[model samples]
Target: MNSVRNPVLRSFCGWLTALLVVASVAFASGEVRAASFQPLEIVTQSGVQVFSVEIATTEEEKTTGLMYRKELPDGKGMLFDFSPEQQVSMWMKNTYISLDMIFIRADGRILRIAENTEPLSTRIIPSGGLAKGVLEVSAGTAQKYGIRPGDRVAHPLFNGH
Candidate 1:
C-alpha cells in the first residue's frame, strides 16, 4: 500500500510541475515579443536628413536605450521621441561607446550638439536646456557628415505642425 501511494504522489507532482513550466514559458515569451515589436528605421540625411532611430517616445524606452548592446552599425542611432517640445537632458550611463548627442527642436532643426560623451560616464549632457528631440550617433559622426547646429533634420514626423 505504501509503495502504491508513493508512485501516485510522484506522478501527480510531475504533472503539476510540467504545467507550471509551460505557463512560465508562455509568460516569458509574451514579454519578449512585446518589447521586440518596437518600430525602428534607418533614415538618411541630405534630402531629408533621415537616420536610423529606435523610437523612445515613452519614458520606459528612454531609460533602456541601447543598454548592454556591444556594437552599433554605421549611420545607426537612437531617436528619443517626445510628445511636446520641452527641455531635455541626456547622460551616458552604462553606455559603452562615445557618442555625439544631437538635440533637435520641434521643427527638426538642430538645436545643439554634445560630442564625444565618455562611455559609462554619468555626466549629464544638457540639450542647451531646451530640446524636443535627441539623437545619438557615434562620436564624430556629426562632424564627419557635416551635421551642424542650425542644420534641419527632415522627417515627416517633424513636418510643420
Candidate 2:
C-alpha cells in the first residue's frame, strides 16, 4: 500500500509542477497579468458618467497601455497617469481597437479630446497642452456620453479627489 501511494503522490506533484511552470512562462512572456481597476467619473454638461478604468501607473504598464487588446467594453477604460503635468504623446501601435483619447489636466479638468483615433496607426497623438493624465476609452464614448473639454474628471489621481 505504501509503495502504491508513494507513486501516486509523486505523479500528482509532477503535474502540479508542470502547471506552475506553464503559468510562470505566460506571466514572464507578458501575456498575462492582473489588471487594477478603479472608479472614475466624468461630469459632463448632460450628467455624470462613471467608468471602471484600469490604472496604468507603472512605467511598464503605461508603456503597454491597452495594447493588443481586441475590445474595450463600454463603461470601461484605461487611465494613464503622467504626473508633473507635461506634454504627452501617444500612438496606436499594437492597439487593435479605435479609442477616444481624453487628455486631462492635473486639476482634473478635461483638456482635450481626440476622438475616433485610427487603430494600429503609428501617427503621434500629441496633447496640445500640458496634461497630467490621459484616459483611453472606446471610440465614440465622448460623443455618446457628451464628454468634452472643460468637463471635470473625478479620480483619486487628480487634485480634489
Best by TM-score: 2
lDDT by residue (tens digit), candidate 1, 25-133? 7544422111322322223354334456666666777885655455666677777776477888788887777888888888877889898888898888888855777
Candidate 1 wrongly placed segments (more than 4 Å):
1-50
Best by lDDT: 2
Clashes in each model (backbone N, CA, C under 3 Å)? 5, 0
Expressed as tens digits, the lDDT of each residue in 56-101 for candidate 2 is 8888888988877778899999999999899999999988899999
Q: Name the lDDT value of residue 30 in candidate 1.
A: 29
| Per-model lDDT | 0.69, 0.91
Model 1 error, position 78 (Å): 0.7
How many clashes would you count in candidate 1?
Answer: 5
* Per-residue error (Å), model 1, residue 75: 1.3
Worst 10 residues of 1 by lDDT: 31-40
- Estimated TM-score for each candidate: 0.69, 0.82
